[model samples]
Target: MTEFDRRKFPPPEDEAMLPWYRGIFDCGFISLHPFFVIEGLDPRLNEHGTLVLEGKDRPAGADFIKWMDQLSAEHSKGKELHGRSVDHMAKRFGQMIGWGEMCERLGLEDHCELDAALRTHIKGLRDDLTDPEAADRMVRHCAANRIFLPVEGDIPPLFEAKLAAMFRRAGFTEIIAGDEFGDDECIVPVIGLDNEKPWITRDDFPTYGHLRLMAPDHSMLAWVHWDSFYTAIFATKERAASLDLDTTFEGFWCAEETKTFWLTQRPLPLVQPR
Candidate 1:
């Protein structure tokens, strides 16, 4: 059976803005057709009542939700309106009048416009999914907030090489590069570990404590989730501060148990290779 390798399927060009679109989609503001089409994958509910792609044994719904939650948490960081966190405000308004109406009242018209453009682009009606104005806005937003988006193009060989070297420096010997997946081209940089066990029954997830690196823009991100801990290490302090780490951790519903460390102040840990 052919397994679905997430590393091989990189994120769409608009990865930085996908969470808002996905949140809108989840709220019934847009159809899932463009989302799946833009992602280059077709997923459906299997007989086991799990969302899966054809020929893949793994259930993908959990991973999809994880990705969404992580990105959405990051997207909401440092964004505020009327002295309330945008995420908090959204949730409150969503609960009262519903998400669709909340978006309408909040003037989130750009999301709908962007979704329409993506659908049109996929159908070959436009040369690009993003307009110059929107692109500029995204760039400025990321810059001002110190948010990092994946670089445009194939993952840089040098960046991957550097990540491998970092793992080696941390005393890992059985490093294996896992398939790239996610809109951010997240890849497991380490794989083999002593006494390793599957984190879950899903075949696509790593069976060992591994380090995953997402695509780099101004900074690189190495995420580790094992032993009931979820830690994300960024290449720079500014980048680390860009995210509301507490809020991000809370999104996992493990704030009380998870211990996060910023790489800017501490040495990276050497876990069994991914």
Candidate 2:
């Protein structure tokens, strides 16, 4: 068998232990789903977890060219082009397909290019994690809205361990290991949003959406976020669908309502023995 056959999809144990609604910060619910397998050999994964398909995956690149050719046929007039222009195509592709696809079409398929891209991307994530202003902004947004960021590789191991210690110091009861999901991180369940109420709105957030969290009376929302990257909030599969959140979080979403707020209480809640 090839690389595809050797790697386990969700790994049998994870499939058994992780509940359907227990979503992680990586790969959306795609890994959890039974239908599709993770593309193991795809050369798009970088140090920072960004997937730059250009020059990385031949199949995806070929498909991109085929699509462009089809677009030309559909929009171009017989001898003289009437409908689609280069500028129009550029805008449309940028908006609809994305920059990665454009790169693939333009024959910029250099897998090594991801090195620089990862450096820049990871730096931005690091800034958000370290800078007080950026951290404040992230916490406030997460608090006010039920939004979570998905950061892949920008976190350092020491920082993650420190964050875990902080979580324990701050009074979170359980810190679960996230090894099965392919990362050096721990998961601290914020709240469980059961199907009954089915939501953890901004109001439900304990510390204005910062790192602080509470274990709800029920365990519906398997809330999680990457400790390395402090800017995102993770939702369980069940809650992710309810909130209409993009689980994979291919890129950061800019919130139009950019504002700031404060929190006095501890971010995560303390668990009292039942």
Candidate 3:
């Protein structure tokens, strides 16, 4: 796992989610699909009384993610479907999304293009979801969100110590470390990118990092949450807003989606292990 790269971006003091994401971009997590997708074999409407997908009987966003993830599942039975790749669709719709444009830029263009098979598949899937006449071909997780932010860098003794202290003081319910958990989940104060390979690397992150959050919305929420969700933990939004954003942001990145905007957005890492 990589240590938080403080020199590349902002510190962990910002209240808005934007700065945190910026920090992640500095580490190299590219936004492929702005929307996290999910697919469910069974479907049900939610409290929103809207279309729903089947799952482990969890949050609405989970259903949405399941619905969208089927980039190929829509063609399972008597169906044929396709659409843009998750990463490609994410980049294409980056304009409508908040931090997506930034995420797109930070990622490398190598694997960032619309994939061939996945591309064709998503196009069909999108159309089906857009206009579903039957049931089984139902797509669920269609909520758009920015999830991944790869972190790379040597650990800074000072920053590491500070965050370790913070987590220790918070007495979180969970802690994590190492590749399995760290690479997939854990949040970091700083993240670095392998712009050359265009993949995210991790210094510290682990499974069961409780700081990892899901999107607040169900159907309108993100798919995997991609270790990139945050809000004012305790402080009110106003209180969080009063705080500085620059001090915590990671800044611009070279995105793979578009040649125009710079990518930015990072995860807030978990300092301890569970």
Candidate 4:
């Protein structure tokens, strides 16, 4: 059997953000896509169920639910029950079971008459799910919080090498390249700002900084980032040598920490010859 490599397959167009490079002098800032979770990151953004949903292999949600109910009934008959049965039941449901079903399954207490309280709690959660005002409030609440940038995807080590070349062009000569942070391998540099305002804190120069290079035609290429910020901006302009420049419409979502980037190695139109 052939091995499955998710990186080999192109992701859905909705999440597409490919990047390419010509030379160190010609690089751009990575931008944020609208589909990016501005509110918060979805932790399970890239995962799947063990069972394939096709033909005889298809798993039915109702059948799984009924199976759990049967187990509950069996336990009630004074039969010896496994202490960790609920763990197994939860694992079986995985992604197929809906929210309400989950609540019901967990609410099955052995001796406590807490059914009414559980129902009330579930009702409140469900109401929030449908309430437009509540939805707005949630967004507002997230906005009010002072921390964290949601990571869209990881930037592969190969791509990191390309970024290093761009950083060299931007006069970041002193670099500390290591894998100290485990899977979060990074290449940090000591870039002297002098009179230029620092985008990242001096203490954070080892982990975060921006690199902006200008092309012969006046086109601008920039890798923008700051300490304590979630989003890193990679921006490119048609002409950086000229006073007036046109901005490229495309944006990318790259993370330096994760092992595999969701959108990896797809060719970008910007890398093609004019």
Candidate 5:
């Protein structure tokens, strides 16, 4: 087995500060939407799941959460969508990018604000589905939910090419024409960030750092896990000095605390000693 599968890959350094990027069912997935985590000296901020929006470019993700809540209340019986096998929901919401459901909820039938794009995508799926041998492609592209970023560093012929090839094998297209960490246009991964200095969400969450998680040695890798991607950021004193480097939000990666947030999944805590 591979090292990570065998639990041999070194655990990431900063369990707190690093932006955890993964499926909706990941542990470090808890963060206020629209927040971003940047690290190192890369000419491009492009990565799989790396959000490329400023503040308002996000398509009302909070509204999406509200809609998901509504869907859960009427459809899901208080059970989170983590590992629960629901074919119908997966097909309807997971496939068509929630366009159908959004339409249904808004009473927009099959045509509305952005139904054209949705319909085009859906038609492609139908075409693939009816054709034999298309099911495999369908399954992989439809249900794979795999990582889709070709992270190619411009360092050398060894590390950079190796990682770039690896991600490409996993289905990511390298679009880097220059010295940028170019990859697919962050297809499945979505992003949000905290812009207002005093990120006051008014909920259980007290405060947020550019780097969400931290360690006692300040040596943790500048990234965290969600379910599918790895995200990094700056830090806060509480988050920075407390083992996660002396970098605080006062200078870089500063953001307000998200008040209303929950992981909605089983969190596998990183039980590292301080």
Candidate 6:
């Protein structure tokens, strides 16, 4: 195990009052995915959910780097990584590969396109993990989309029903259930394409499903989920206004370049079932 400075990633001072921070701490370990994916850190998530530092003697780390290096060399020579092609790697890792690598391997133009592709691929993987047709899908999906799926079991049906009722009360009806992939602890829902139809029930939805509310025109209005501690709401400005979220919770608009919505407080109390 590579030693990390706990002081550098100190627990939030207000964690007791903030549900989101509390929920993260409850997981028992902080993931270094963002550090690796965004900042090019040496750590990567292995199949066992352990962090492996690239080029280090932390046995797993060394093996992972060696494998990746071999794959890269083979790729340059127009060969597959081991027997698996780049396409196979993409389908297996989902969004874990950096945007540049994913685009290069998948022949995509940009990150936006890569995001769309991963969402579809991950959905299929989650829907049928045991299907013999794709034996490695589960492993690949987990490696790529860790923390997005529930580790123990599905979110409670009764809680989901209450969440649905809350959304309906807030005037959102075209809700679909599914997981969203992103860096933040909260799941982020993307707007469904025009050709896609919403699933009618949780059973019809994929595993680790969260509630995604859509506007009448199929634009995403909000992505909502409960982390067994508090509800996380990511909603458009207009939708957040409808819910009086700005007045009720501490939140901020996402980065101007990436999205046009507010990530309302880590743990929202407004919709918690009494």
Q: List per-prediction Cα lDDT, in the order shown.
A: 0.29, 0.27, 0.26, 0.28, 0.24, 0.31
Model 5: per-residue Cα lDDT over 1-274, one tens digit each: 2223101011343332223222111121111111111222121211222222223533575575565556445543443332212222222222122323333433433322222222222232234223333323322342333211211111111112222332233333422111011111112110111212111231222223221212222222222222211232232323323322111111112122211111211222222111
TM-score for each candidate, following the candidate numbering: 0.20, 0.21, 0.21, 0.20, 0.18, 0.25
Best by TM-score: 6
User: Rank by lDDT, descending?
Assistant: 6, 1, 4, 2, 3, 5
Q: Compared with the true structure, what per-residue lDDT tens digits does model 6 show for residues 56-125? A: 4335545675776674554446322322122222222323333344345445554334333333333422
Which number leads on lDDT?
6
C-alpha root-mean-square deviation, candidate 4 = 22.1
> Model 4 over residues 74-175: C-alpha lDDT tens digits?
544542223323223222221222112222333422201121222222232234223344334323433344111121122211123334444445444544
Residue 136, model 2: lDDT of 48
Model 6, position 249: C-alpha lDDT score: 29
lDDT head-to-head 5 vs 6, winner: 6
In terms of lDDT, the poorest run of 10 residues in model 3 is: 214-223
Query: What would the per-residue lDDT of candidate 3 be over residues 81-196, giving only the tens digit for each residue?
Result: 22212223222222222233332443313222212112222232334232232111112222122222221121211122223333333433233322322235443332221111
State the lDDT at 224 in candidate 3.
Answer: 18
For candidate 6, report its TM-score: 0.25
The candidate with the higher TM-score, 3 or 6, is 6
Estimate the lDDT of model 2: 0.27
Q: 18-46, model 2: which lDDT tens digit per residue?
A: 33213332212111100011122111111
Range of the 10 consecutive residues with the lowest summed lDDT in candidate 6: 27-36
lDDT of 1 at 14: 31
